[model samples]
Target: MQTKPTKSIYWGVVRLLGNNFLMAATDEGLCYLQFHDANPAAGVDEGAWSELAKWARAQLPEPNWVEDAEKLQPYILQLEEYLKGLRTTFTLPLDLRGTTFQQSVWRVLHEIPHGETFSYSQVAQELDKSSAVRAVGTAIGANPVLIVVPCHRVVGKDGSLTGYRGGLRNKEKLLLLERAGM
Candidate 1:
């Protein structure tokens, strides 16, 4: 039986950079980062604002304007601070969604540490098959969670910004933000 996709509210702040982000959860745990610039899957309703905010409030204990109190709020705040050069690292629990290989890539992305960036080729080598650079890019792109997973830190072999599902401008901004300090 095909149950219709339920409408879920994704909530987050419009960062100083003018981006709308929300850490949204499903029955499966925190599942996605809603980025305004990206084209979202149409099958899943984008959901209603007040409805989403209300739902977001219900799910998280101390929901921020971004919605949901779960660890995601502090994560966003600290990330905002970090982008402003007030923080060096992100300390928040994540609810990642993906296959084992994708999860493995995400784990590696987190440990990439603050202020450092890696090339797609380098990540592929770390994943154990140097030849999997393209696959690494795919996995990186497949990363549903941003910043927390730090996909923006991954760049092209030539140190040029590549396609960031979130928008390459966002990618460049993040890189510049990190390099500006730590």
Candidate 2:
């Protein structure tokens, strides 16, 4: 019988800009990060942990989850710096998992300069797949790493804000933060 690989994923909660976020990392590097809860009045959702587990399982058949804030501090600090408009580019290692096409789309997203917004069509064009605008949008939606990957930098062709996993409000805030730095 074949055995599935066992992977240990470290996770922790971080608070920044008055919001909570769930971050996870592997021995390889930081893998997952998402908004835990955007509204404190609604209370923190315990299900966020399970969401992390579900994502981890998708990456590795056997995922061992460990809560280690110290291990995730570097990621947290860099994120804080970015949110505070003190950092523009991320230098930390990222372990992003996705399909080949999705990876290609994400690479384009990374190329988007900080504080600059690119339309979905523009992203597709960057990949030389201008006809794959919808596919590019789907790949951007599936991005696991948020701020570091800069999916928030993608806007509508008309320059309006679009869908974001972290909520449109947070997306707007991130864009504003980046703009403020410039």
TM-scores of all candidate predictions against the true structure:
0.70, 0.92
106-171 per-residue lDDT for model 2 (tens digits): 899899999899999999999888999999999999899999999999999999999999999989
Candidate 2: residue 43 lDDT (0-100)? 42
Query: What lDDT tens digits, residue by residue, belong to model 1 across residues 1-182?
Result: 99555544344434345656645654344555645632223222345344445544544434434344453555567667876788776665555656788887887888786767889988888889799888788899888767767898887888888878678887887788777784
Q: Candidate 1, TM-score vs. the true structure?
A: 0.70
Global lDDT scores for all candidate models: 0.66, 0.88
List of clashing residue pairs for candidate 2? none
How many clashes does the backbone of model 1 have? 0
Of the candidates shown, which would achieve the greatest TM-score relative to the real structure? 2
Off by over 4 Å in 1: 1-17, 26-30, 37-72
Task: List the candidate 2 regions with Cα displacement exceeding 4 Å.
Answer: 1-5, 38-46
Worst 10 residues of 2 by lDDT: 37-46
